[model samples]
Target: MKKIFTINCGSTSTKVAYFEDDKMMCKSSLTITAEQLKEMPKTLDQLEFRTNQVEDFLKENNLDPKDFDIVVSRAGTIPSVPYDGAYEVNELMIASVTYAPEAQHASTLSCLIADKLVKGLDVPVIIYDPTCVDSADEIAKITGIPEITNMPVAHLLNTKMAGITYAESMGKDYKDLNLIIVQLGGGITLGFHDHGRIADWVYDDEGPMSPQRAGAIPTRYLADYCYKSNKTLQEMRMYLCGQSGLVAYFGTQDVRDVEKLIDEGDEKAGLILKAMAYGVAKSIGQLCVVRGGNVDQIILTGGVAYSERITEWIKEKVSFIAPVTVIPGEREMEALAAGGLRVLNNEEQVHPYIYYPKGYSSIEDIINNPNELA
Candidate 1:
């Protein structure tokens, strides 16, 4: 039987699991608090620390890291790759992620951790559907700003797997279906999968408000605030991506706490949550317009999809577009394992990681940028 080890690193936690063929053998997670994060500001600085934690987890679970025939992980900050699939971890990929100072996320450590786990062992390390996966249609890449072509970046890991899961359930291939995947979590994004390629996607700041993300805000107002409010770019990012949304209103990031507040007759909390759902519904309606209203399925999957309140609200609004499938939680481990199993079973070819620092797969060859920015 083939052995697979999956690693999923979030902002504050590292989740690792072991699998034999298709059956999971053991799983564990190591969590770090905000205080702990503050001690190590750089994402790569925590690499050795996280890799050691994974080794400890293996020891505690009586699973040897050396015994892992294949190691797969959630990709973090790689330069934009053209397609979605598994890519073998290599020096180019590692250096691209490590050197990208502006894009250092805690999740970026997962690739480093995956690389470290099989240092001496001849085990293959791969990452499935990284954040940089760009399979959107060429027209979708264009925007008002030329240099700032919005490359397809969303919750590719969970959402793509969810699409495949729903497709198989209906006895259809993922590439043969027109689907809209709604990824609701700490960060919310929607992707319009036209047959196989991700035709387009709604990004972080242009979608519904997540539990933490502020989502789509007025561009004119945001620009005015940036100039008048005297907040730095980093501070503004923290506001929109970290301290905004439900947390900005309720002083908490957990959806469960927000639900409790709603249950306790807090009209304000209830209103905000409902508004979030309303925004999600509106976003789904927008994506349906991508293919001229020929959506086959709409799958709501992610950590937040488990919420009956939000899902029901979205369902009431988007059920008319297509049949909605609720596949709650980010099944990244399973997806990673499946990707590894494909490599092991020779069902798919694994590509070597290539770095494209300025974001590859541009729709147009010539995009003017006098300042050479973004």
Candidate 2:
């Protein structure tokens, strides 16, 4: 049996699972409190602390890291990669994630911790369905600005797995269906899957507002507000990503508490929740057009998908397009473990790490000096 150790790091928790072949043996998650996060200067500073927690969990479970045949981690924000699948962890991948331009999340420390745990062992470290999996068509990359191009960033692992699983239930292959997937969690991303490839997806910052993200806003107003507010870049980043959304409106990120207010007859809470669902449904409609209106299934998967109120709202708005399948919760650990098993069993090939420089390559130079400009 192939032994696999999988790690998925979220903003507030680190989830570790042990898998023997396709069966999960054990799983544990360590949550870092807001007070503890306040003490750290940067996300990377928690590397040692989080690694220690992993070690403690392994010890408590009477497990040894060296006994595992392979280590797999949830993918983090890094330089864009072209394909999706298992990628062998290497120094280049680590360096890119460590210095990524976006806000630092706990996932950036995943490979670092995995590499540390498997040091001196022959076991390979792999990352599956990282957030930076870009598969947009050339036409999809065009933007109004000549310098700025749209990039593909979404909850790819769980979203893609949800499509595959749903396709199997219908006795069809994922590659033969046109699917629209919406992932509602701390942030929201809606993806359009054309055949097997993700043709287009709503970037995290450009989709519906979620429990903790601002999502899309008026760009012109944002520019004017930035000039008037005088907030630092870091503060603005937090406002747009971490401190906006429901937290900005209600002073809390917990959806259940928000639901409680609605249950207690809070009119404003009810309206806001309905608005969020409306935004999600609108995004789904737009992506359906992107798929040429041949949508076979619409899948909703994420933490917020558990909310019957939200799902029902979304379904009522978009059920005319196709069947809506609610696969609640982020099934990241299972997806990672399944990816590891596929690679180990030779069902999917493990992709080698290739460093692609930032920015577009020259259109004129196709044959020679391809690496001249990034």
Best by TM-score: 2
Model 1: residues with Cα > 4 Å off, grouped in runs: 229-231, 359-374
**Model 2 spans with C-alpha error above 4 angstroms:** 100-103, 356-374
Candidate 1 TM-score, true structure as reference:
0.92
Q: Write the per-residue lDDT of candidate 2 for residues 219-308, one digit (tens) a residue.
A: 898899878987786667767887789999998888998999999999999999889899999889888888578999999998999999
For each of the candidates, the C-alpha root-mean-square deviation to the true structure, in angstroms, is: 4.3, 4.7
Each prediction's whole-model lDDT (CA) = 0.83, 0.84
Q: What's the lDDT for residue 166 in model 2?
A: 92
Error of 2 at 351 (Å): 1.0
